[model samples]
Target: MTVYDNCHLGHARAMMAFDILARYLRFQNYKVNFIRNITDIDDKIIERANENKETIDALTGRTIASMQEDFAMLGLELPTHEPRATDHIEGMIKMIGTLIDKGHAYHSAGGDVFFAVRTFPEYGKLSNKNIDDLNPGSRIAEDESKKDPLDFVLWKSAKPNEPSWDSPWGPGRPGWHIECSVMSLENLGKHFDIHGGGPDLLFPHHENEIAQSECASDHKFANYWMHSGLLKINGEKMSKSLGNFAMLKDLFVSYHPEVIRYYLISSHYKSSLNFDSDSLDQARSALTRLYQAASLVPLQESDLHEDSVKGFIDSMNDDLNTPEALSILFGLAKSINSTQDAQDQSMYASTMKELGKVLGLLNDSSEAFLQYGADLTDEEISQKIEERNQARNNKDFLKADQIRDELVSQGILLDDSSDGTSWKKS
Candidate 1:
């Protein structure tokens, strides 16, 4: 996780998706040593610290603390090893030295070290792009110090008044790409089972890491790559510029973190999740329904339905197909809800909660989930009012009226006029 800023919804999506995956693996009795790296030192961190007029440590420390708080609140299981980049600088420097010793990398006259991309015959294999295609018509402006335009920086040259470390290539820091290779190598060895990240990293960041690591370490790396899809607002990418940027902190104020997790994992992990109030609405409804089933029968030991258990496992085994797994969970819930047979209800409820643990859902008591989960915070009510106004402005009357009805169902009456809508709770 980058320590430059607050973790947004996108960050939460990737982290939660992996968190459930790790849970399932452990449930399946696999020894999973999950290592999530913290990038404390980077160009972004430096720039952000300078902008905030704070020391790098101060900025990163605060951000890391906040990230931990947010993760804990979301009930994300802690990683087995959380290695910070600054803590592994020596590993990075040693790897850089190894790359330089090989014919795969070179030192620039400008005191920077760069990976010689042309030397690596399989440079574009991971990204599936031809080198000729990437550099077609001088598309990318080459850095004069770089041997080739595609050759990324391994160790950037130190500048005045910036953070620096004593390296063979003068005093400088490791580039973003080199940090991951070093951290992963240090934690998981030359070849690990899985390397996971957001889809955006596939191109340059991941592709560069592959080239640098393989060339440095006998052409070996992670065996499998898992890329999570993006989280967007409405249908477009969430950005501050797009006026749709959201922070997880703000969302937590409105909805429970578990609800957010449910919303995030409702769709398949590999598919993009379009987040909005409507999506959250569905997530809450579904989670409550599951909780409702668990509430139907007393919590006790009962034989789980073999078919439902097998179905859940099958769906999850199929590349974490959470949507199918959720349907199976709902099927159990439906059995409990539709039946008056106490023994059958107990059996289904036991199975529902048992399977739900793998996905980090259905832990809450039915009474609490039904009551607290339905209640909106004051901030959430205000936010809902704003969304309703937005819907009205766009002439989406159906959606506008729906938001109003949802708020009203919460026992909050709205007074509307030219002055705008104001809410009063009775």
Candidate 2:
């Protein structure tokens, strides 16, 4: 199984969703080979590069690097192979040649090659659409050259000053749909366990892949098809035109990446996740409580007691039900917080850590996470502490308690030990 990341480039939600699935599959003792293809050569990439006066290589390279950083921050294991569309041009050419030889594709006089949808017997199985009901889009213009209007392009004829590659027809590039078909076949063979992407790609992109690959290989394409729902902001769909699309870098400036990951995973993968500052803030507070409980327990190197942690594994194994898994984790956290016994706390903490490994959250110290921003200066905190001490010395307990309360509100917890007073982030 593999999750495509074209639209969710900077967002870690897509990767986290698949991580939960992959971990669950591993827990079930299945050897899954996942392959996620990077569309390095797309019309959007070229258009964005031109608008920014940058080259396509520079744009894709920078975005790919940022993607890697985001993936690391989200704790996603790398896929078996990260194939680039441009890197597999040779494979695409061979596949296209096979389709032409099999009489499933034809070339136009303008050097553009298109797939003959009527030639394929199982053209609409994946999409469950009849050939007569298919309509033409802006891309499928009224061309007398095409045998059928439903036939999509396999290769686009390159114009002057555009990216071009030598093919049997002429100098042109591969279409958007053909890249995935060729890349997946080249890396994972004709049939694979699963194929995934955003819900929007289900119509043309994935549908066309099914048509081309099956017609060429005379075998199935993928065993299962998985898709993630679109992200929304508040009640509106996130889009560049609305100026409501939040970039991952900008969101990480004030919020921790883990908080964002938690917010994204809180809902089911197939459900629409509404983004808002309040949602992230709630996630932050929830994680803080979990981490605080984790901090109270000591770290253990012992293996997890499966009988005790069976609920967590069960929730995760049943179609990767992360929301239920989170509820189990929260229950464990509550148990740890309510315990007064030292040995029980230790056992609960160890169990919490192992279960957290599956969810890919709560893997950090409470102190470090609370002190994420260097906004508060040491001298300022010292001055506040001095004022509070002065209040206490004057027997004005009310003022001292107020000052301490203010500090705690800022995520600074105060503790008075036999040695002296100490402060830590809550």
Candidate 3:
């Protein structure tokens, strides 16, 4: 789980999706060792730093801090180990030397060391595609510097004014793919349980990692590989050129972080997620129902709903089918709302909260969630409700209805119960 760039919703979808799996495994009493690496040094980071007229350290330091903040806002459980690529440069250099010694890599006349894709007969094993079928754009230019067109760089030669590290090949930096292989090997060892990332990494990135790592270690790189599906904004790929690139913090101005998290996990991890206001509103409404039901039960710990918990576990086991797992929560929520017995309500609420915790959700108090980020404060809404009650008592029904309508227009839904009126954000 190595993240780069501004850490947008696409990153959030993957992070939260994996977090759900990690938290679930932990709940099941499985000790999960989740190692998410950070790619601090890359061509993109260098370009951005130069464009912003800042030192590389200044840029990466700021961006990494901001990335951590964004992850916190999304309620992501921190990984067990988070190694940065720059911090593992020595290990990366050592691995590259091993590749060269094993004849899996070559140091070119141009001073760049490249992994010989042809040497690794299983080059396309993970991607399940032939190198000849790959688009020419996927590889570097077919220059004399590389032994073959498919050969990917392990060490990139330094350009003037660019960041580089002293390596056996020369004063150069590790290539993008090699960084992950080295970092993963360093933190989780040569053979770990799982390797995962966004779907885009399934091809050249992960494939290259597999090629380099297994070639060096002579053992399996990972027992399993998992990749989350792509996230699109309004059915279009989010790109700056398309004017659809969305920053996660910018989304927070209108939607709560929890709402965004729910929207992300509403779909299966391997299925595409379309980011749109309609989808977000639906998630918001769904979450509100769960919170409303949760508010009914007396706040006390109770045993989980056995049946729903089983359903959730089954869905998650079946390749992280979050949509089906979420259905279990919705069903539990419906039961909580329909049941009249206080004990039953408490049981249902407890189950929902405990299960939702695995998905990084439903932890907030129901009232807190309903009133979170509302335009009107608790005191303000209470004052207005009191004023409306007085209006109704004075036989000013029209004024009371008007006040209710006004609140509704402000995205507040007021429900009149026998006890009193309760409100939630629409």
Best by TM-score: 3
**TM-score (C-alpha) between model 3 and the true structure:** 0.93
Off by over 4 Å in 1: 136-141, 239-243, 373-426
Q: Positional deviation of 403 in candidate 1, in angstroms? A: 22
Candidates 1 and 2 compared: the better one by lDDT is 1
Candidate 3, residue 92: how far the Cα is off, in Å: 0.8
- TM-score for candidate 2, residues paired by index: 0.88
What lDDT would each prediction earn against the true structure? 0.84, 0.77, 0.85
Give Cα distance to truth, residue 165, candidate 3, Å: 1.5
Sort by TM-score, best first.
Answer: 3, 2, 1
Worst 10 residues of 1 by lDDT: 366-375
Superposed on all Cα atoms, the candidates' RMSDs to the truth, in angstroms, are 8.4, 3.4, 2.1
Error of 2 at 86 (Å): 0.8
